[model samples]
Target: MPSPTAFQPVATAMPDNVRILSFEVGHGECTLVEFISERQVAFRCLLDAGRVLPAALLDHLKSNPRPESPDLDVVVLSHVDNDHQGGLPGLLEAGISFREYLSPCLPAFKRLRWLFGERVNRAVDRAFAFEQQLRSHKVAVQYPLEGFKSRYASSRVTLSIISPAARLIKTLASGSPERVSALVSNSPTPLQWLFEVDEPVNEDSQALAAVFDGRVTVCPEDFDTFLPGPPGPPASSLAQQHSQGDPDFFGNATLNDTSLIVVLDILLDGVHRKRLLFPGDQENWTYVAAQHPAGLGIDVMKAPHHGGRVYLRDKDEDLPGVYAWLRPKTVIVSANGQYDLPRASFRDVLRTVGGSLLCAHQRTFEALSAGAMKQPTATSCFQSMGCDRGRGRSVTVTLTADSESADLPACVQGSGITGLAPIVVLRQDVTVPSEGLLRYTYGELDRHATWIKDRLDEARREFLNKLKKTRTAFDAITEQPLTSWRVLAALAKADGRHDLVADPDPVLKFARSQHVFWCAPVTGYRASPESFASLPAAADFNAARRWLKSIPSLLLIVESGNRFPTGTARVEILQHADWGVFDHLLAGKLKHPAPVIADEVRPVLLPLIAADYSFRLCHFNYPDSHYDGGKAFLLLQRDSVVIPDLLSPEWQVAWDWHAHGSPFKAPWKILAKLASEQMLAGTYLQTPYGRDALFNRFKPSTTTPLPAAMHKARWVTY
Candidate 1:
């Protein structure tokens, strides 16, 4: 038996340098920092673990062993938001130990409970559970204070807490915890409970809330009244409605505003240094910007709130001030399409502020590997030791003290680091299949067939195992079978698979029928095989033809193979009797003038035309042919165009004579001309450059023949 191929490690050698790795966890932030000493001793610090521990981070933990013990130097849970701290439980379960755990939530939980009232006890309880987990792992837990600094004496790496002032905590704790509890108990409804705890605190919290309010547009008016207690009837009405649906919205925002913003300064041999500013979901940028320490320029900035639009002020005034203070050259954001982040507006703002945007979720390891192969020096660390493995997106940066500042790559420069090499590593798996048909033809055929059968059996077992897991998960979610199916259908749709509704299984069919109003067809067409199968034979034939044309023609061709042309011809005969059967048959179906249709339908149509009219469509080099025409028509339609210059006096006569004077006028010429017009129209409609040029040339004149010649030229020879 052949050994299973192993995935090559992208980076093997660990140099005595400073490096940062940002993992893509879908609308979350997870960063790992490594400081290696001259003697190769290393200290690792993690900043948040995102909502889930990505497969790549877990792989990293398994692959990279610590010199002394399998432990991280520090783990900073910057905030208690699910996106930031949700992966902690999984990391601990994986036996990845940490020396110190730092977070503001652990120490300020008591005060946070008082500010939010007893109704927010669920969030508070989760935080307490997290703290207990850290303690169970024998990790040192510390609360970040304003001006609190932790220094790794050996490596000269210092992390300084710069936000959530001590006074802020005191202000939040000013109201009596017992008074809030009593108010919660006596409240008529959960909505009233919030109003009861709306007693005013210090001016700092109010100012922070005011700053946040100006930025976040969708925050309910009730949340504002509940926090600052501005007397208004509209607020009361909103509070009543919101309490029935989402009561904890304001509490979540308040928790984010109190995130521990930190500045990490790394010094190499006392002279060479680098700084990173990690503001974990801190939306109160105005307050943080005002308190910004002078002479603190950041090399890289992990943008707050996953580059959310809410962090940017209405007029772009606050962001510029913040950027001016920190002067970050590279802004890293961790986001995915699911969350609609980081916002395009925020990215534009970053670009305007002269900062390069590097999104973690957009970079894949396979792409990085290809990039490394093309530019070895620029992406030197991206070399794979065996094929890459993981399901995450990540960007890695390696900085060396000895490397000359002038010799640094553009990426390193963009990140504001003077002497660094940046390498982006993504989580991907590369597999190489076996080649050579000789082995299969010889004695290996039987063995190969048996091996394939065994593999299929294994796959079936694995699929069944997965189904079992799904069933268990569904059972845990709900007791009712129909409810489980509906929930699963919704989850599947959210994951971008709408075909689940079309499954032939009785359960899925029932689920689809029940949710037919909400569950639209994935391909924008309503007809399906099951639907057609249930119809009468006479109606089914018509429905089937419509369904065939509605789907992608390429899919039909691939699925039916040689049967496609016959099937399509039968449908074509039923649809049209004359006017060049195939052309007329496709005209109505591909009427949209969509390039996608042309691209898919043309390749299959061309071959069918050639096969059906063998004598009429003989190769160009054949003895009977007058013009150079075979598959050349394909090229003419796609590449060559009848520009206005060709229709001018210098070339028109020659072209006309050459085209019309042919002994046998080519049938392909008509097809080619139609294809060209379709191609041009598609291009003009799809592209801005083509559209602009087309509109610019649209002048009102009877003698103007250029537009017709360029876009609507007819084949006179055919």
Candidate 2:
């Protein structure tokens, strides 16, 4: 079998570099940092392992010499949150060795018992068990305290603990270790426990800054903890009533405020080049502003708490959102749509602040945005390596005396097809159609298949082109002019996955589409599949087929023969239709004057039109809760309204809806009301500009035709 390097693409190394990788661990987070010196890995550390340890690190460990070989220098558990620390046990089971394990101190866990009643018993026991296992493995366990410093691998690389302040530890240890454990009572109604107050434990999370080659990166793990109690009730009456139903009900509200904020300063020889901040899930920006009154001029920031709702402004102080105060040029978010995060409002805030957003999982945001915006890059490693073997985003920054650079690229080529949209299909278990419906699509399956085929072909050619020599057992058993199927069999045998030879396609397809959410392509990142059949034996072909059926069908039936884009009407059907269908429709012929339509019913109207002209599409939709949906007008103007002219500053468009409320409320009183609700759809325009939002404007009236020998013009849908 060919060596791993023979098949994997080799990336050129920089002399001194720091590579920060965040994995797509469902709704969790696992990030890895590598310190490279002289084109070789000098040190490695992990911030969090997420719910399930990333497959990339697992594969690397498996390829090592033995369990004794140290794969990592340190592993930091951000907090006790299941989504953060759930994967540590798996990492330990993998026989991976590390020098140190950093996390919240043990005393803090003990104190949490009394503070949260018996709700934290299971979590505390799990933490204790994990610590015991690490001790058994002879790995040193350390609690990150403020100002703690350590040096490893090379004296040039250093780690400085920044948070979980000494004062916080003192406060935690002040409480008694012994507290009454709740006892069950037998009665007609179940008993309940109530608390007058609650303390935030998330502040005990580990926060540290690492300096390599004189460059620093800070990781403030969940510093949402504040010493003083919040203004509102500690735990709501509703929470007390349903506390038994939700495991983390009490801690949910204030947990984000406990996030420890980290700052990374990239400087070479004391000259600052860049600053990056990782605030974890910190929601109270006022705390951050208090800490840095001068303001943090950050170049990039990982959106706090997966872009959840944050307290961005301090009304009394008259301060701006943290993004605006810090003025970060780029905002990176790590989330996979759990609890509907990185929220739409959060993304809009970033755009409004002029910070370009980069998501570890682009499809997650794409589905959330619902075509209101598009995530431009597939920055996650899962996109390049195929979710089967590779995981998360790998953002590498190289620092040298003369230059500093940052690059995020997906290994494989992105899909050329545009306007590929996601469709939601309600599940059988769903009760509320609007909120319960799940978005489904075939995410990058075609690209993954093609990538696999290319690798097989490359391997076969290299084997055939070798110089003539005595054939070994490997070469003699194999046939000449090797086919792709034969190559796959060889790979399966090498990997000890014999089942893969029988049915490889289904197994790969099912695994490759795991993390990505939407049907469209995410750009950026450069890498390839590191191994074949990296996962355990998958279910049979029929089982995989059943799983694939969960994705919504893209096929659409064109209505009205004359109304369709091709003008052939009923004969034109859209099979596997993407959002690109809109482009074809806009360019295609229309039989009648396009009516003012609602954006909510765009997908619903696809199956009709050819069915009936007067069929009201809005009947299938729910009532509008707010006047959030605006209108778009596809006005036709000759060469006068060109693309560039519209983009110029002189022609900049702005709409102030607040200045004139309710367009219909005073339609006769205000002349502007006739077109105030209408926005420019520009069906014929195709440019990168104005793609994020439609330009709202007044519709213009047409004049009488006076050109000699004028011909009838055709119309298209917006």
Candidate 3:
């Protein structure tokens, strides 16, 4: 991705402050400005720009104002780089003339020298052209700085210059040829001063002060602190030179040492704030100590020389004004490319004095490249304060595999999944998620099952959504003759997650519609029908209403109850041989008692067979086992086929997969058996409430197994 530029306009400036917009690599553009108030603004000094006046960004700045407002008081040029000055020429070309202004005088500019040639003065010639443009309107020329500001008391614009003291310039101008040449050579050229110089050889470079509420902000453009004083000099020589401390021969630093470093103090509406310090291409430390005795404390301090040790104390131990003076919460290193501020002296300044730092470096760029963070810009440092804890700890879905369960995706662990939990991925899943979305991989991390399963689930959901769009056909049954049994089965399949319905609204739409009359069954209805004796009544409005749709007088019946032969009253009884006629007679109290229960040859389900075809009860019978009492006789999905034993909490908890189909000739039982055999290869049995899945590799006796035609069947759940 393309990296955004460092400087951009936030909004139009007003009487008190101006707003600036900038973009960072991983983050988008951010706009901030100066606020004018009284209290020192203290440790939280931010660049305060004026009010955002009414105007379309690019248009307003360049066009002249109407006659009613006239023109502005001052046209302050903060700095000379393209980012800060991109619109200045157009504004100047327009009739929006300012009374007074401040800008650095350029000695030699590569572009103007290239365009207008060296012989003709660039600044003078440009000023002359501007003068001529004003004359066209019969206006008099007014030099903004020296004469105009001194004469006009009405003009509120004032620049308290903080750089290039005449005293230091005089000393440098009188320096030995070698020192003077070194200073000039070492000083940052107009091109080197700023990172994004669009047209090279910025001969018109004006490294002025950036203001926030009349306070200055330091824009340290490409200045390095690593330039040692007189390259080959030993420590003793420097120490000897430093002890003398004569202003004329400060010894060792360069001529660019005379370059002005500014800190702006802004006051407005009873709010006083010391904004930022903009260190121009000057690399001098001692000059400040000698010229100004106080330690310079500021709100935001742009790093000197890109965090180099050059800005050190006499002994290079105490970081001059850092700890005692600077109060920088944000130390920006605005470099175009990569560079690490070396560990030693710089860290001391940061730890002891400069405070926290932010930079546009390799790591910042890498995050942008990986799609994890945004690109480089001025705002990125402020935005990225703490490391983000992505997806931290509230996921709910889980996928279980035999000897493995990779349901939870790894990317999802720290994040919340309540927001429509992502369909876990699976190769065999319905569909794959779009690349645009964030994916997860959390199942068995060690074995990497999670990765596999999540992808499968995602794939499955993808396919199923498509599958629904294209309908599939099967053996046709009459749509009519619809029973409560069929409706329950369909509802169970649609809502039960075992079928994995990615979209629930449509399926649920159908289920809710079945409640057309939307009436409640008789307050938690429970119907009890008996075959030989009295049958229970249908209790609710829906059950009563259902009779209107039912075939009249359909005799729905329950199975006969089991009655064991009784013996004489005793705690323990003998076998059948010990039983006498009185025992049999007492059990039934009849001379000839007809049996209520069917014989053990076959398990009878009279309640199911005699439902008169309106409803069907699906159940399974497990042969009696020694594990507990008798094995549980389970009702897979029936309201009336419940076992009396289920009432006991113990049996309810023990019966895990003990449900539905019995070992009979029923089609459903056959399908269940087929599925059991196929899944048995590496199936797992999760108990009613199991933490772990136990492997069940049960294979059937028949090798042929079931055909695909039979395999297509859907296995209903309990």
Number of the predicted model whose TM-score against the real structure is largest: 1
Pairs that clash in candidate 1: 8-386, 8-387, 9-385, 365-426
Candidate 2 per-residue C-alpha lDDT over 1-718 given as tens digits, one digit per residue, 9 for 90 to 100: 8877687767874446555656667667676666555655566777767777778768754653233337887887756666767789988788677888876655444434433423344555566688778878888776665455676544555665544444434334432222111111001111111100112223322131111112222122222232222123222333464453353434432233333344544443334345556665555454344334445676656667676655533212111245555566666666765666666455445544556655554332223333333333433322321232224454444445454345653221122214655674422221131110111111223234434444554553454355234343222212123233455567657766555555555535433454211111222561322233211112222232332223122212112222223343331322212222232222111110011011222333444433421111110011122111222111222222221223233323321111123111111112111112221222212223232222211111234221110111121322
lDDT of each: 0.46, 0.41, 0.28
Residue-level lDDT of model 3, residues 430-488, one tens digit each, is 22322211101110111122222233334334543554454320101101011232333
Worst 10 residues of 3 by lDDT: 473-482
TM-score of every candidate: 0.42, 0.41, 0.28
Name the 10 consecutive residues with the lowest summed lDDT in model 2: 183-192
Candidate 2 Cα deviation (angstroms), residue 610: 88
TM-score of 3: 0.28
Q: Which model is ahead, 1 or 3, in terms of lDDT?
A: 1
How much does candidate 1 score in TM-score?
0.42
Q: What is candidate 3's CA lDDT for residue 95?
A: 45
Q: Which stretches of candidate 2 lie above 4 Å from their native place?
A: 1-14, 60-69, 117-121, 151-155, 175-247, 252-256, 259-276, 296-300, 312-320, 352-354, 363-718
